[model samples]
Target: MDFEQGSINISDEVLKEIAFRSFLEVLELSADDKDAKKLKKNIEIERTPDDNVIVNVKTVAPYGKSLVEFGKKIMQNISENIQRMTELQVSAVNVSIIDVVEKIEPAEEEE
Candidate 1:
């Protein structure tokens, strides 16, 4: 008699969590902050029956020239990182600009 063990199965949820954590590391985000962590963030991941992965990421950025450049840089970095790190074929990484954050003004101190 011969017996064979089944291969390990990886769930999509697990993959998404892994991807999200990786995103944080690549983006240099504060992973220590539970609220700031991508995995814990409002991002959503969907997997098609054909094994294609789709991710929609919503991020807030301050309105400025540098911030615009940084946002673009972040998007590129995310695409590259996902491809390099995951075995699952990524169908697309869609970024939606839902909100713009204004720069915070420093409060004046009274002597």
Candidate 2:
């Protein structure tokens, strides 16, 4: 983006942060989730010659969830959030499901 003064550039770290947060939102995981920190390391952002971004995300899908649906949700969420927040175009969102783990349910408190 450009202004009368100069152009605005967003750093890759910021873009990655945006993408990660959007990814977590779709998965309904909090930043404090046991795997959040490790999962964050799997997000990567690349810039294209056309000045658009391509996001590559690797994550473990919870068992019992449809992998296709899960990947679509993540791709849509990340693309929307990044474009909405940064006004940058997302060329593509590539999601890689690395593994599947059983869903962990929170324990209920005893009455």
Highest TM-score scorer: 2
User: Scored by Cα lDDT, where does model 1 land?
Assistant: 0.56
- What local lDDT score does residue 91 receive in model 2, on the 0 to 100 scale? 99
Q: Give the distance in Å from residue 103's predicted Cα in candidate 2 to where it truly belongs.
A: 1.8
lDDT per residue (tens digit) for residues 35-57 in model 2: 56566777899999988999999
In order, how many clashes per candidate?
0, 0
Q: Which stretch of 10 consecutive residues in model 2 shows the poorest summed lDDT? A: 102-111
lDDT, candidate 2, residue 107? 21
Candidate 1's displacement at residue 27, Å, is 5.3
Q: Identify the runs in model 1 with alpha carbons over 4 angstroms from their true place.
A: 1-8, 25-27, 66-72, 103-111
For model 2 the local lDDT of residue 105 reads: 24
Off by over 4 Å in 2: 33-35, 104-111
lDDT of 1 by residue, 5-36 (tens): 65554566665665566556544566575445
